[model samples]
Target: MKRWRHLALLLMLMTLALLALPAYLERAELQLWLLGPAWCG
Candidate 1:
């Protein structure tokens, strides 16, 4: 029972992180796009 609970918590966290990854990548991409040229020049 305790192990099951821990597994469920781990699964939930993994799901949340998977869901958030795209948005995090998108934000990073946008930041790079917005700032890339300035840095390059």
Candidate 2:
């Protein structure tokens, strides 16, 4: 119900972020941005 809609909306926003992020940063930087936090631990 309402929770499903909220989850769907969050997923859509994440997909949009993925699509829009590449245009804002270089491929290498983008990879680092995605992986940086994991490597920090």
> Which residue segments of model 1 deviate by more than 4 Å?
30-41
lDDT of 1 by residue, 1-41 (tens): 99999999999999999999999999999999999999999
Which residue pairs overlap in candidate 1's backbone? none
Candidate 2 lDDT, tens digit per residue, 1-41?
Answer: 99999999999999999998877578778789899999997
At residue 19, what lDDT does model 2 achieve?
Answer: 94
Best by lDDT: 1
lDDT of 2: 0.90
TM-score of 2: 0.57
Report every candidate's CA lDDT.
0.99, 0.90
- For model 2, which pairs clash? none
TM-score of each: 0.62, 0.57
